[model samples]
Target: MSSAFEVRGGNRLQGEIVPQGAKNEALQIISAVMLTPEKVTISNIPDIVDVNLLIELLGDAGVRINRVSRDVCEFQADNIDLDYLQGPEFKKKSGRLRGSVMIAGPLLARFGKAFIPKPGGDKIGRRRLDTHIIGFERLGAKFIYDSDDNFFRLETNGLKGTYMLLDEPSVTGTANILMAAVMAEGTTTIYNAACEPYLQQLCRMLTRMGAKIQGIGSNMLIIEGVKYLGGCEHTMLPDMIEIGSFIGLAAMTQSEITIKNAGVEHLGIIPEKFRQLGINLEIRGNDIYIPSQETYEIQTFLDGSILTVSDHPWPGFTPDLLSIVLVVATQAKGSVMIHQKMFESRLFFVDKLIDMGAQIVLCDPHRAVVIGLGRQHALRGITMSSPDIRAGVSLLIAALSAEGKSTIQNIDQIDRGYQYIDERLRKLGADIRRV
Candidate 1:
């Protein structure tokens, strides 16, 4: 792929679009596969850049993998070569995805040591790994920050679990600690754990692998460490973020679209968030039907006041989808305050929306006020560049809804998270092409 892409937009996307598996969940699940020395089959893995890159990293680590189908992968972790996993190739691959941080605890638990490089994801803002480090330390792991190498090397003779409380509900931090705790010598109690569906899936996978874990869907978790883990087959849930993004896209373009196989159980607080922007959705069986509601009016609270949409940790609204929410609010009828507390730079993309004729105010690095266009003014298309993954997709939706042709550059950032977005949108009658 090139360093960037040029997208010609301005088409009303329509038709049914099925989202790929959850990229975030897939990453954590794949990393968890390394906990056992048996074959683990993972179905519904998204064939995006991140998953492909992580699979290549796993292959380099000497884990045997085979593609059973387009979205199904069979993984055997019996032969991970430590020497192959410790070099620059590992760092190069691991640094490309934030989920790479999740491998630290699993590798340490399985091999007694691990060298994890700093992870990379969207340049939205500062994502601290302090919670992860502290959690592992409480589980009897010592970390060595290799200042010269820019890697954090963690070692342990044998993991011993203990009771600990998390300062914040960090998703990846909870995943890392959970992986470590599953194989520790004693019982590990984790309080304030993020009880997202992905965490529940991870716990289920661990249980199938013969590890004892309790408190599956709450802030507290008690894990009885086991001697070893076996392998199992699991299917990933649908990507709720993708579903939400598509809902925003359909609303922005005034298109009737259906999102198939969206896991509603994991979609807590999402429909409510979109409802705040007056984007009505119809649920038919497992699919979400978003009709063209061009006359969108932001629904105020019961107190009859302005509404605010803020991103929090898991189970709360996801910070990853805030950019999409902000974009969706621009087309509604009322004003809203979008609070992005997780990342300092996520709200920076509002400038592009502002340039596209959306009324937005950058209150600070973490907050923005969006005044809806009241469906009177259509956004005029213009040349724009993507800065990050979610922002890039948000721009695409804006461009698709714009009146004229718009070109978006740096779309590779968008491709990192979304799989074949142009082709998929084209299938939905979107006039999008990559150049």
Candidate 2:
């Protein structure tokens, strides 16, 4: 596949861009489709690599999939081929995506048996499967790990709901347990649950499909098991991470861009976090209007200490956007310490930015100190490889604001999440070409 983004920097991009459907939400929502045999119609699904791969994996598992439109599709899992899941081919196919682990939840909940390969995704850091495994075990599922094949077999005669306080509010883990608990024998209370908008959207979609869930936007969730789940239509929210990236892009490139249908209410601490960087944002009736910034300054704390941005669970800054935040800070007028608590390797990409003439100190695996250039120093763009989804876009943003042409290879990493990112950026008058 063609996979390099050639970017011409120093363009004052202008126009309105609508964020694509959320990638994380699509993964969780599509996995939940397997819980019911009825047709589940979903709208606003992003045409990204990972989502498409998950859809293809579902099709290979004998789930009926229909493409209603570019942004709409229907999925039905009435005829899952269980034997195929046990074969070597299943492991080879399902191992391609981390989202594939989510299928185990519905399969175990519905059929009482599931075989899943060890999932594959960006190697940003060690993304623990303990949360998923222990959560399933807590829901009364018997799990077997085959170290030889690196596969997992989960079986249960019946799932019995119980209290499960997650070690961390893992978004995918919460979605998996929520799917399993919805059809269990009794009520399940999940504390310290991931309450991100993605999980909230998943819970809302499950509710529309006749599942009982309380605490839509809190760390604690109460789910009462139900026997049957019917089909329902669910629409994914706009990709908030992409929106945050776009906001960073506009600020770094001094562009005037308006983000449409931004779902402003659901952006928990995102806009506030951006405001902390002194990047001005105006919300006009569900749209975010970012004017071309001449001088965006970073903020300091109350005691006049330098501000520090860090990632936490939901209601805190999302770790996914910290890369974008780090990129945006490169051009701000002040200094900020970026503490990426979730993923260790995520902050390592700052070396690439430093190579482009940005002042950055790679303090450690999880932290970086960036002293903004204040538009006085123009970054000279160079070739780089995208390390992961977020970092790829972060580099792309840096390239867009830099002084010369930049070539970002391994753009497949970026494609995994962002939908036709080059095309989307071009719509905003960005001179980016996918070569």
Candidate that scores best on lDDT: 2
Error of 2 at 97 (Å): 0.5
Candidate 2: list runs displaced more than 4 Å.
Answer: none
Q: Estimate each model's TM-score.
A: 0.97, 0.98
How far residue 119's Cα lies from its native spot in candidate 2, in Å, is 2.5
lDDT of 2 by residue, 1-435 (tens): 657989999999999999999999999999999999999999999999899999999999999999999789999999999998888988998888888998888998899998878767996988888888898899999999999999999999999989988999999989998999999999999999999999999999999999999998999999999999999999999999999999999999999999999999989899999999999999999999999889899999999999999999888899999999999998899999999999879887888898999999888999899999999988888999998999999999999999999999999999999888888788888899988
In order, how many clashes per candidate?
0, 0
Return the lDDT, model 2, position 262.
Answer: 99
Model 2 RMSD to the real structure?
1.0
lDDT of 1 by residue, 185-204 (tens): 99999999999888888889
For each candidate, what is the lDDT?
A: 0.86, 0.92
